[model samples]
Every structure is written in C-alpha cells, then in structure tokens.
Target chain A: MLRSWRWAAVAAGVAALVSLPTLAGALPTRSSDVTAEELRDLVRASGAVAHEAYGESRVDLPLPDVDALGDVPELLGSTTRTRTAWRTPLDWRVDRLTVAGETDVVRAGALTTTWDSADRSVTRLLGDLPVRLPRADDLTAPVLARRLVATPDTVLSRLPERRVAGRSAPGLRVAPADPAQTLVESVDVWVEPGSGLPLRVEVRADGQRNPVVTAVVLDLELGDPGARRTAFDPPPGSTETTTQAPDVAAEVDRLVPFLLPNVLAGDGRADPAGLGTGGVAVYDRGFEAYAVVPLDRDLGGDLLELAPPGGVFATPLVTVLVGRVERTAYVLVGTVPEQVLRDALTALRRDPPPFVGDR
Target chain B: MILTELAKLVRRPRTWVLVALLCALPTVVAVFVAVQEIAPRPGTGPAFLSAVLDSGTLFPAAALAIVLPLFLPVAVAVVAGESVAGEAQAGTLRYLLLRPVGRTRLLVAKLVSTLAFTLLSVSFVALTAYAVGVALFGSAEVSSVSGTEFSTADATVRIVLTVLYVGWSMLGVASVALFLSTLTDSPLVAALGAVGVLVASTLLVTLEAAAAVQPYLPTRYWLAFIDLYRDPVLTRDLLRGVGLQAVYIGVFLAAAWANFTTKDVTS
Candidate 1:
C-alpha cells in the first residue's frame, strides 16, 4: 500500500511538471501602456505631421531595366506582373498652394509668395515667395517614431538586448527568410533608455549591404503635451463663388478610351454616363479632358476644393472634386493628363448642361 | 444524479459524433493553413486561423448571427432537446423516473448533463484548433492587422479566454432547448421550436424598424464573446454577457420545471 501511494504521488508530480509551461503561458502579460493621444503628441513634438491636408501620396512607374514584364506564378495560378524599378525623382514642381493660418489666405505663383484668401481664389502676389513645403501625408517619420516608443509588447519578445546609435536599446530585428518576400527584409530599431523614444531606425533590403532606408531625429522638443492650435482666414478681395462648372460627359467619353487602357484594366473602365452635373475643364496643348459628378448631399453648403495637377498617378487614376447641391455635398474623381490639361479646356464649346435632379 | 445522466449521455452515438465533428474543424483549418504556408502570397500567412477565430467567435456568441440563425442553433437545439425528450420517446425516461428518482432531481440531472456535454464540445473545438494552429503555423508571434504584435503567452491567454467566452455564449442555446423540450412530446418539435425562436430573433435584429429593440434582445449578447479580443479589455461587456446568460438560463430552467412538473406524461 505504501509503495502504491508513493507511485501515485510520483505520477501526480510528473503531471504537474508537464502542465506548468502551458499554464504559465496561458496567463496574460501586462503591456507597456500608451494611449493614441500620447502617440499623437509624440509625433507633434518630433515635428512629424500626424494628419495633414491631402490624402496618401503615391508614385507609380514601370519597372526600370526589365525588357518584358511576364506572368508570375502565384499560389492560385499565373498572374500578370509589372515591374517599375525607379527611385522617386528628387525634384518636384508645385502646381497649387494653400496655407492655413490665423486668417484664411490664398496664394499662387511660380516662386514662394503668400496670397490673401479674402478673394477666395488663387491671386498673383507681390514680394518674395514663402517657404517651400514638404510633401503631405508621408508615413516614413510616423512609422519610425511608432517603432521607437510603445514598442508593442507583441514584437518586443522577439527582440534581443543590444546597443543602437550609441544608446542602450532593445533590438527587435525581423528578417524574412525568403528573398522573394516583399513585405519587409529586416527592421532594427533602438529605443532610448530614459524616455523610451526610438532614437534610430534601420531597414535593410534583400541584397543590400547598407540599410536601404534610415531615419533618425536631428532634434526633438518634448514641450507642452497638448493639441496644436489651428486657425484659418480668407485673404483680401477673395470672393466665395457659388456657380460651379456644369457637366461635361461628351469630353470625358472622347478622352477615356484613348488614355485609360494603357494605365488601368479590369473594373477600372470608366462609365461615361456616370458623369453628372457640374464639371471642371482643363485645356493643355491639344489633349483635352473634363469630368462631372453629383455632390454628396450631406455637408450642406461649405466645401473645400483643391487642384493638384502635378500629383502622382497610380493605376485607375481618377480626378477628385467636391461640392454641395440641394443641401448635399459629393466628391467626384476623374482623370486628366499631366500635360495638355489647359489646352483640352479650349477644345470644348459652351452648351446646355446635361444632368439634373438628385435621382 | 447528474453524473449518472452525463454517463448515459456519453454512451450515445450522437455525442461521439459531436466530439468527432469538433475534432475535424481544426484539422480542416490546419489543412488550409498548410496550403497557404507552402505557397505564400501577398497578405497571406499563418495568421489565417486567428482571422477565422476572430470572425467565428462573434457569430457563435451571437447565436442569432447569420450562421446560427440558419443552421447551427438548430443543431444545438436538437442535441439539448433530445437530451430528455428523446429518452422519454424511447420509453427510457418513464422507466428511469420510476427508479426511485424524484421529478426535480431528474430535471436537474438532465440540465447538468446537457451543460457538461456542451462544455465538452466547446473545449474540444478550442483544443483541436490550437493544436492544429501550432502544427501548421509555426509558433511565431501573432500580429494584429493594426500592426500590434501579441507574444506566444498573450496569444495563449486570448485563445483560452475566447474559449471560455464562447462556452458562456452556448449556455443560452442550451437553456432554450431545455425549455422547449418540456413543452413538447416529440424531440423533433422541441428542437425545431428552439431553432425557430433563434431564427425569429435574428430576423428581428436585422430589421430597421426593430433596431431599437435589438440591444435588449437576449441574442445581442452573443457576440459579446469578442470582448476578450479588445486590447485593455472591456470588463463591462463580459460581465453583461455573463449576466445575460444567467438570466436566460434561470428563466428557461424555471419554465422547464413549471411545465414538466404539471404536464401529464401519457405518451
């Protein structure tokens, strides 16, 4: 009986040992707490724009050096693949500029200059041009900062203790085992010991010895931890106009077939009939394009409009427009050529508007 | 008494089938994960199980969700409804009730046995899914779509909590089945009636006119199982889910007792 009891006890002890790891693993671990508001403040202090005017910026180009793009085998089947191996051009031209300040203002010029928003439209301004602004909505800086601070506990476990950029930092390195993988090659970030802020970020590409991308802060100011103040004012002599341009479906039909098939395929084929009342016409050299669509009926009367003729074009490129009709506001996007946009407007003759009613 | 009833339940072919079906779900999920792993594509990886779990937990918890309204609740209703009614139909309940067992004790035993079986079914689902997940998708860090990572430890806790939450969710279905079982002589009628209630609640939730009444409906608390996935966690919803389950269980048990005690068992 004594021996049997001892054997039972031994078995129980072994069972407990076997279950320990699983039981421990099933317990939730506390993560470093950081709120979204705190993250927004950190971004502001780092001079990184959190939310800015304009949507996400995209640059699309054909893969450089490749003679012919071929069909690549996917898990499902063969898929057509196009390669564009071009770096972002270092130089860029500004097409239109709008600045928000203590007062609403509008300015237009080839060089840096401030214009009054009172006139409610682009006006030629005298004196030296204002400072050239950086591209809006770039994710590089914000992504780098997020990697530094509040290193999500999920990714923290995979990191090893290491020094980065002369600071004692947690090294959480991720590298895709496969070379063909495009998501990420390797990510290395260094967090400051004192403030938990990321001091340096390095990302290495598949075949590159040196990191293909690196971002480090030149300086940081942890000032008043609060929201930034914003103010808008219109410039002198600027008049708010209610008369929006009428629909131009005929012009859109004439242009889509010639320009679309080369850039976008599949469901991207634009239906010319969808263009409704109120459109803009741009004329450039000889190529012409126009677009018109209904406004969203929700935003009442106020509308913000911007025209960036020199913006990047991805596949299925569409023009964007917003306005209110009958207490409803809508946003319409259409395609226009980079060059010859102005000349296209000259080709269209004035005619009775095409679309009417909310139906 | 409950243990005796539970033992008899385990002997049933249907109970074995439930266990087999529970085991098969993970195997199917594992095969899918293995296929994706062998030939990975953009936005495809081992996290497929997590995505399925995220979506599955909600539908199961909200028994009136699309899937449950159509089929799953009916299946649950059949199992729970037949727990007592089927035995009675087979002439076993009359014999067993005469074997020195009190009426209240028999009802209690039936409810407990049903609850135990349901718990076992849910546990099998959780364990098999986790085992398959670990085998097919290497035990790597779990990354959320929001780019947040969950360590192996955190993932385990989340999975377990999710399982417990789903078990609580099924209690309401079991209770409804028990109540319906007391109402009818035919097990099939009881099962169909329970499923009908579930379907009606689902339809009510979808109607714009009934939108205001949806939150008060017992079915609303079903997807509250997902409260486990919320970072920082919302204890209020979890508590409310449990409270709602308790209410359903109590009401169903009361109705079952009142009806079973008074009804004549001539059939």
Candidate 2:
C-alpha cells in the first residue's frame, strides 16, 4: 500500500511537470494569426479610412513569455555557457506609417527616415537611424511603426492554437534570436479564423502578466488597389539647388582658422567634460573635402543634423552645415566660411560616411 | 536577592542554549541563502528579500496572510511556552519558589530574558540574510518595482527597521505563550497549547464567518513591519503595532503574575 502511494505521488509530480507546457500553450490568439489575405480583408471591412493619409500607424505588440538568458559562468575555461535564459513578455507600441505600396517609408519624430522611391534610396531625413531610444522616451508614431515592420525575422514565428475574441484562432510568439539582450520576448497575436484579422494581442515577460493590446475591426473598406497609387511630389516652395564642387585644401584652411580661434579662446576644452567629447575628422572617401564632426553624445547629434548652412549658433558651441545626403550629414564647427561649409557638405554627400558600408 | 536570581537565571543551560541558537541562526540562514544562490535555478536575491518583507508585513495585517497566521506565531509560542513550564516540568520550580525572591520578580526576569532572546534572534536572522545576500548578489543599489532604487546605506537602514518591527510583532505571540505557561505544569502541554492557540487563530482568520473579526485579531499587526520599507515610512502602522504589543505584554504579564502568586504549585 505504501509502495502504491509512493508511486502515485511520483506519477503526480511527473504529470504536473509534463502538463506545464500544455497549460502555457492554452493562451488566447488574435485575428492576425489567420492568413494575411484574410487579415487584409478584415482591415478593409473595419471601415478604416480609405486613401486618407495617416502618417503615423500605432501598433501595440503584446508579447508574452520573453526568454531571458540566464547568467551562467562559462565552463572548462570557455567564455560561453549553455544555460536556460530568463524569459518575459513585453508591451510594445510601433508608430510607423506605411505609405500603401510605393516601397517608400517615412518615419517622423526623433530619428526620422524618408525613403525616396524615385531615387530608390532611403534617407535619414532627421536625427539618426539604428539609434537606441531610451526607455519611456516619447517618439513619433511613424518611427515606431518602422521598427515594428523591421522587427528581426527570428523573432517572428508561426501562430499557436488558441481562442481569441470569442473566435477560435492561432497566435504567433515573437522573440529576438538571442534570448539574452531581448527587451521584449514573447508577443502572442491572435488572428481571426477565416478573416485573418487580428482580434487580440497579449504580451508577457519575466513570468509577469502584462497588459494586452487588442484591436477589433468593426468595419472594413477595400479600395481599388491599383487606382489609389500615391505619387511622390516635393513641396511646392522647395527648389532643388546644386552647389559648387568641393576644394579640400581651401576647406581645411577655412576650418583651421575658425577652429583654432575658438580652441584658444575656450575654457581649456572644446565642450563640457562630463557631457561628452566632440572632435572633427576629415575622411578621403573619394570626395574632395568631406569633413565629419562626430558628436560623442545624442544631445548635439540632432543639432549637427539640423544646423543651417551658414552655422548653428547655440550657446557655447556653433556648427556650420556643409552638405546633407540620405546617409551622410556633414557639418564644420567653429568659424568656417560659407563656401568652405558648402564645399565640405558637398564632399560628404559625394563620398558617404566610412561606416556606411558596414551598415 | 532578586537580582542575583535573575543573573543566575541568565546563566542557565536553557538560557545559554537560546542565546547560542539566536547567534547561530544567522550562520544557518547564510548557508541556506548561499545554497539557493548556487542552485541551478536561483531567484534574484534582492527580489527574494523584498518578497520576504512583503510576506512578513502583509501576512500580519490580514489574518489570512501567510506569516502571522502560520509560521511566526508558532515560532514565538514554541520559544515562550518553554520558559516557565519547562522549569516546572524539570522539577526546578520548587527550588526556584523556595528562594526569598517574589513570584512577580521571577516572572519579570523570565519575561525580560525571553524578550531579549527574541530580539537577538530576529537581529541575527536579518544580519545573516543581508550578509548572505551581499556575498552572493554583491552590494548594489536595490531597485523597486516602481524603478526607484535605494542606495546601500538606505537599504541597510530599512532592513534593520524591518527586523526590529517584526520583533515587536512577535512579542504578542510570546506574551500569549507566557500566559499559557503559567497555567500548565507540563512543558509539553504548555508548548502544545500555545501552538494550538496559534493554529486555531489561523483557522479562525481564514473562515469567511470570522473575516470581520480578523482586524481585531492579534495576528493583524504582523504586516506592520512593512511600514519600515515604505518610502516616507508609515508611522501609523508601526505605532499601532507597538501599542497592540504593549497591551498584550502588559495584560499577559499581569495575568501570569496573578496566577503564579495565587494558584497552587503542588503538581
């Protein structure tokens, strides 16, 4: 009898362990888990404003069960160890607007990017791309939307079987490839059966239940896919202006006079010590007079991006924009001349940043 | 004579055992924490400490909570119930009473000794927990769920205050046990009876019908320890815990003294 009781206890423990994954798999799914065509149809039915340009698309991603890499010391003198990582779900909002089907992308707010379909080029219209946004920082909806569309492929997976919004559906669990360093781990989006529309989205992380972002389509409008093509047009008053070729020697000379005067007059340093370091480096990337004034911090990064051609005169520092391109934004700091600044910008636009190739 | 008797009482084998147990508690807890740290699935040390504090504080406030309704009161009862009744059961009470010392003085010394041991034990637990936590997790800033972090200095102060508050919470249990001890000649009977009261209170606290009565229960003050960890500190809860403990201590001591002086000791 005692032996049978012991066996029963062991069996119960084993059964419990085996059933945990099944229990976890029993979570809800969203309408987006259905076919892409069905989802498009549901969106069309939802009475979403047709052809009305919405620059910012806010997508709330609910990820449950984010896998976090566990801290395990490397074994046998190796610097890597195999360990089960910590996993948690995450609540994420992506605010980027997709301009229908022109292959053109525009991200507004901090770290703006504009894709010019005519030139078949992507432009960092504002701030910087691939820049890490600090937690809780307010960013424009478009910027977040781009991030959502550009989510790592490894994080996207096939949907799981579940019920969502009173409908049977499948859900997808999205996670970064490297479980470690994942800010958001598991987001389960449940797609409506047959319609392929997203009905519910749940995010979980670190064994804590996070809030879900759910969207229900009340109406759908599918316009003529071909008739509503968007045409790219530059602003009415914005004119295309071509600048003169760069003169490396003359540009360098202009920069030296301006930089030397400020360095000598300043309080021992070019910028504040704790804030960050700033320096200028000239690269001969096939361009005549390309100058790169790299700011060590983000505060001045935006200033350098938006500085006018003559010079940006912020207190304690000034920078003159030489030229701008899709990837490269060139600036000369101190008392550089207008011609020199224009020349440097032209060179930078032509030559491109050295790290552009790696990116 | 009373002072001499109390001093001699302090040197008794049981008294030294209690002190040694209290002192050794930190080491044992440290070992347990270290083992957990080295385990395959280790919980975050700081998080575990916070959870322990939460459990400790919330449990006493609501009788249905885990700590006060179960573990803490039982621990207090076990220690306090063994005090006078153990002496009586060991045939030492006759010798102790034959002395010129008054019953009230004897009871006072015993109560003081028990209270001292309780405080020492709590302090040892906290110190050991902190030391083990530091050794394993390193001395870093403790971050709360709200994202606000406490520096090492603040964390230390908070931990000390938490432990002291919990000690006062336990005093209520100790008084109940002491009172029960006076009624029983058999140490086991006294200990079991004290523990039984704790178990019954826990059951009563859990019952739906007794839910309204829970606020008045002695175990309700257990969560008062959490007041120490709050940012501005909730002095109201701490004051209430202290006041309730004072009442229990006073009432139980009075009852014990009255019973010892009047009751027959011919067992």
Candidate 3:
C-alpha cells in the first residue's frame, strides 16, 4: 500500500516536472545589452534573410457597416491565422487558415497565385498591386516592424528580454518623437537575437486600454524554402487561370480629374508602401498618416452620400471621411484625429498641391 | 490480465455499436455531399469537408473532424466509465481481487483496455470513411489544403498521423472516465460524470469570458490535428496538445491507482 502511494507521488512529480520549464519562462529574465539603434538595424537586415513562420495576428479595429465595401470590413476587423514561406516581399506564400479551409496566396516572381480550396481553382495575377487593402500579410511581426520604423520621427529604446515564439527575444519600444503627430501610443517589438527577425509586435493606439493590433510568430525557421518550394505547382484536377492586372498607378494617374495635397495638416506626404502613383496617395510622415483614394465621380459621390452615422463612420482606432468636391469625389481614411481627416478633405476640396501632376 | 480485460471489452456488444455509430455519421455526410454535388462553401462546415469533394483523399480527415467534437469522446467516456464500475456492479471485481489479481495490476489492465477501445473505435471510423469517400468521389488526385498535391504515400502518412492524434486525445477522455469508474460502483454515474467533464470543458473553451482558464481546459487543442494538413505541417499545437493530454492522463491515472489500490472493497 505504501509503495502504491509512492507510485502516485512519482506520477504527480513527473507531471509537475513537465510543466516547470514553461512556468519558469514566465518569470522576468535579464535584459539584453543590445541598444535600440542596433535592434532597428537588425530588424532591417533580418528582412533580407529568407525564412518561414506560422503565427496568429489579431486586429480589434471596429468596422462600420457599409454595403459598398463587401467583406473588406469583416476581414480587417478580426483575428487572422496564417502560415508564411517568405523569400522576399515579391516572392512569398501566405496560407490563410479558417474554419472552412485554407486559401493560399503565393507570389512567385512577378505573378501572384491565389488558390481557392472550395473551387479547386488557381488564379494568377500579373504585376505588383499598386494599392491594396490591409491583409494578413501586413499584420505579421517582421512586416509590421519594418512599417513602424518607416515612420519618420519614431524614437526607439531598449527594453527587457521577453520570451516569444518559444525563444527569448530582446524587446525594442518605438514611439513617435513628437507625440502630437500620430495616434499610435507605442509599438513594442521583440527580436530573435541571432537572425534579427522580429518575432512579435504589439501596437497600442493612443488612449486605448488594449493593444489595437498584435502579431506574433508562434513557430519559425531561418532558411529559404528554396525556389521549388516557393513555386506554384497546381495539383491534378485543379483549374488554373491567369489574368493581367491593370497598372493602378498609371491608370489612376491618367484618369483622375482632381488632386490630393502634397501635405495635409501638419504632416508631410510620404507613401511608405511606395504607391507613388497619382490618383492614390497616402499622407503624413507619422502613424497618424491618412490615405486618399480618388474614386470615380459618380461611385464616390454615391458612397459618400449613403455612408451611415451622418456620412462619417468612426471607430475608436480608425476614422473614415467621404465627401464630394465637385466632379471629383474622394474618400479619406486614417488613424489620425477626426479633425485631421476633415482638414485633409477640406484641403482636397480647396488648395491642391502641384507636386509633379500633369492634370 | 491486460489481454483478458481487452478481450472482455472486445466481446461487449456496446463496443461494436459505438464503432458503428461513429462510422455511420461520416458515411451519411459523404452520401449527401456526393448526391447533391454541393460541398459546404469554403470555411463554413467542418474543417476538411469543403475540400473532400474536390479531393476524396481528405475524407478520412473530414471524418475525424465530424466525430472528434462529440461522438468519439462520448464513446470513449462510456466504455472507460464502465470498465471497473461494471465489474464491481456485477460483484466480480471483489472475487477477482480474492483470486489473487493485484489491485495495481487490475487498474493497469482496465486503463490499457480503455486505451485499446479508443484506438479501435478511431481507426474503424477512419477506415470506413476512406472506403466511402473513395467509392463515392474517387481519389484520382490528392491535393492538400495549401493547394499542393501530396503523393498517395504522403497522404496516407498524414491520415495515419491524424488517427494517432485523435486516438491520443480520446485517451484523455478515457482516463477521466476510468478515474470516475474507480470512484463509484454505478457504471451510469461514472460515464455521466466523465462526459460532464468533457461537456463543461467544451462549453468553457468556446466562452470568451473563460479565456483565463481556457488554455488548461482538456479540449483546448482537440482539433489541432487539422494543422497537420498545412503545407509545412504545423507541429506547435500538436506538441502542446500531446503534452496537455499527457498531463491529464498522468494525473488522472495516478489518482485512479491511488484510490483503487487503497479503497475498501465492499462490493
């Protein structure tokens, strides 16, 4: 009987030992000697390395109900789980997992392949998409880190070591040097010490209790998946279609009648996405930056007229403004204060910047 | 003694009935999907069901998903819950103990038999689903969820891994039921008690308010086997699920042994 009791104790002890390492990792560890500048450089260099990761990204941005937007609103307002094999921004694959099935968007060289599991079809699009909505790809740790650092006046500081993605990664905090310029409170990033990869990122918009966005790498490997792995090899019984995507920059530059200002409010015009195209423009040098879309006069006007909550929809973290300035109707969206959007709309309606526009 | 217990379990009519019920569900679903020629829109129904029509190779995976949430766990709970309790209720356990079978050995035999039942039931369901799927839709091309074609051999490997994962998860349920079986002579009460834990775990797992304790819940990573179909098989959740189930199996089996070996044998 006593031996049986000892056996029970032994079993319980083994269970405790199994849990000990995970519990110990939660305890605060010593901070690394890396500086903020060095971490920034590391993150930038990490972008050049070929690697793959699987992670879950969460966005708490509340989207307004709009008929014109289809599913874009729901897509931006929920958690996105993905597995990525990235060689470069132009050549990568993101497999989005959902309860229904997996949809893979693979970019090989100049063509992007979207494989739909339901239809058993592959659609390949040619050329880079000049301007696109935020996607699962944009919410990953490394991609988000690079975007955060692109903000002109962000100040970086060293933070204590934190465990993420099953590894101890040193932390770096990035905030705007001038607080009044952006809506972002701070961006916290944890880096893989060896590869310099950003393993986790948490973004807190101003005045929000919870981080507005969080993207963390749950599993990672630091080697190229190779060209063969990156290539789109459609299996048997799968239908394939290839379509040429119109050059958005050239089309927008040639078609639109009006112009977006070179600068809006106190912020300068900078397109971090490099969408230097004419009709589509993103303003501001900070996180408070707003995007300007030159919609066709009739569709833009009708959408602005039908927008709910009095032709302006606002979430705690994001704001959208739509208004008509004569024949050229515009939709302005940003994370800045509502006043900034109004001012940008007013500027679009009023004095237009002549920064290299032919029209 | 373990072999005897397993033979006794295999001889029971209830075991075959449970296995039949588990397989019937996926067969019925495959029939409807085949006859209608309309699979659930991507991301609407069970995980792999949407793609099963596209590639019948996913049928076993889809079948696992169909029964995993409720049927398999309930079946495991019922058999394990009846293991020791049924013997006690029938007044055979005390006599068997008197016949010189060690208390710890009896408990070990009972646990092994329950594990065998889990394995038997899960594999039977997979085998049935594979036949139904291949016959109805045909497995000319085996495509993974990530749009890559898996060789027939590779597909079989994934199905095998899924079977092992589902079996391991069912073992967690069996341990809970077996522990309850040792606590009471009433088989029904033991089975109900085991199932109650699963029901509560499932309910709490889906509740956002229960987030703090969700990770520790038994069913937290139950469906993680679906991650195996991913292009580069995601093993993080699989490893965690295995570890969590191991902890549950360890703690509960120890408790059952501690109680059974020392408890008064009034029956």
Misplaced by over 4 Å in model 1 are A1-359, B36-72, B144-147
- Candidate 3, A44-124: lDDT as tens digits: 877777888888888877776555554456667777888888898778888777654577788877788888776678877
Interface Cα RMSD for all candidates? 23.1, 24.0, 2.8
True contacts kept of 3: 0.51
All candidates' chain B TM-scores are 0.83, 0.76, 0.97
TM-score of 3: 0.89
Q: Which of candidates 1 and 2 reaches a greater lDDT? A: 1
Chain A in model 1: its TM-score? 0.28
Consecutive 10-residue window with the lowest summed lDDT within model 3 chain B: B140-149
Tell me the lDDT of candidate 1: 0.43
What is the overall TM-score of model 2 with all chains considered together?
Answer: 0.38
What value of lDDT does candidate 2 attain over all alpha carbons? Answer: 0.43
Q: Which stretches of candidate 2 lie over 4 Å from their true place?
A: A1-359, B1-47, B50-75, B144-146
Comparison by DockQ, 1 against 2, better one: 2
Cα distance off (Å), candidate 2, residue A250: 59
Give candidate 1's chain B TM-score: 0.83
